[model samples]
Target: MRVRYLGPPAQAPDPLDGRYVFEAGREYVVLELHAESDGSTLLRIEPSRGSLAGLYNSRYFEQVSDVIPSLWGVVTLPGGGVLLGPPKWLSGEFWELMMEREPEAEAEFEAVRDEITAEDPVARSS
Candidate 1:
């Protein structure tokens, strides 16, 4: 998913290593969104450079799109089995993976996706 950096997380100081990572107001493609225990989420943006690394706090970005990060999430397929996505998807690639791996269930998967909704962080600002 895409997101635009807002700055350091609202609840924290600037990351000591951010100079090598995020650029203020820059848009980034998130590599993953990790579900957090505190009802918050963590993001892994495609690295700005190879020198620094760490999952970023989601509070630092305004969502460019919807992304639901939950380890407990479950999607029932048309078949009798369940589709299990990792608690946190890599580059938020779960949907693609599901469609690719379950061609026969494409319509079913999409139907499920359409039935879900997440509050867009960016929209909340407006």
Candidate 2:
């Protein structure tokens, strides 16, 4: 997942070119996951761009799933925060929370992204 720094909600940014970019923000991350009634873990993942403006448009934002493989269920944010679950399963409220960037751990988050890109072919292709 490439880090895209969006400007504002009113304007769109350049096309992601198949890159999955989530908004940079500090949302309530689930430090741990619990088993659901079906025995599968149900985790909340808020993978939104830093802001609406940071993304080119809603269509592009929706396409985020294309870059992320459904089999993988963990996202490590630049700040070392973890987003657990599939992007499509994420709630709208979660996406909204991504509007603000968590500046405190920006460096860490970026580093993590870089590491993921180097290690994961799915992320790199996206």
Candidate 3:
């Protein structure tokens, strides 16, 4: 998937938020993106036609590449799997990363985080 900034640059009070569009396969979807307090980003995807009503999709972008400080997020497909994306995304390229990441679905993600911390607490803490 290819993502590009859509609207104007971020301003004060909410410099982390940006309007972006992503080409998913053959469809281009609009998304309102906001950098979480924690280092992650929140993507509120606009529902498409014939999509499930009263249910909007949300995706979280986490820091995956450390060498250059990039973010990678995954969105669960309507079918079953997920689509991993935002590869090569950098702060300088698009937007800056916030200091604290958001705590959405913390309980769900905590499980995997526990395993990561258990394996390497020092690295995880950093």
Q: Pick the candidate with the highest lDDT.
A: 1
For model 2, residues 1-126, the per-residue Cα lDDT tens digits are: 222323234545444322344443322122123243343333222244232322232222221222333333655445444444434323244334434544534443344334433444444455
User: What TM-score, over all chains together, does every model reach?
Assistant: 0.44, 0.26, 0.21
lDDT of 1 at 95: 47
Off by over 4 Å in 3: 1-27, 50-126
Q: Which structure among the candidates has the greatest TM-score?
A: 1
Which model is ahead, 1 or 2, in terms of lDDT?
1
Give the alpha carbon lDDT tens digit for every residue of 3-86 in model 1. 787765444455632444678888765544555545556665545432222467677678776555333244443534343333
Q: Relative to the unseen true structure, what is the C-alpha lDDT of residue 7 in candidate 2, on a scale of 0 to 100?
A: 28
lDDT of 3 by residue, 1-126 (tens): 112234333444333332233232322222223344354544433223322111112331232222211233544435444433233222222212211222433332334333322444233445
Q: Number of clashing residue pairs in every model?
A: 1, 10, 6
Sort the predicted structures by TM-score, highest score first.
Answer: 1, 2, 3
Q: Clashing pairs in model 1?
A: 31-91
The 10-residue segment of model 2 with minimum total lDDT is: 25-34
Q: Residue 124 lDDT in model 2?
A: 44
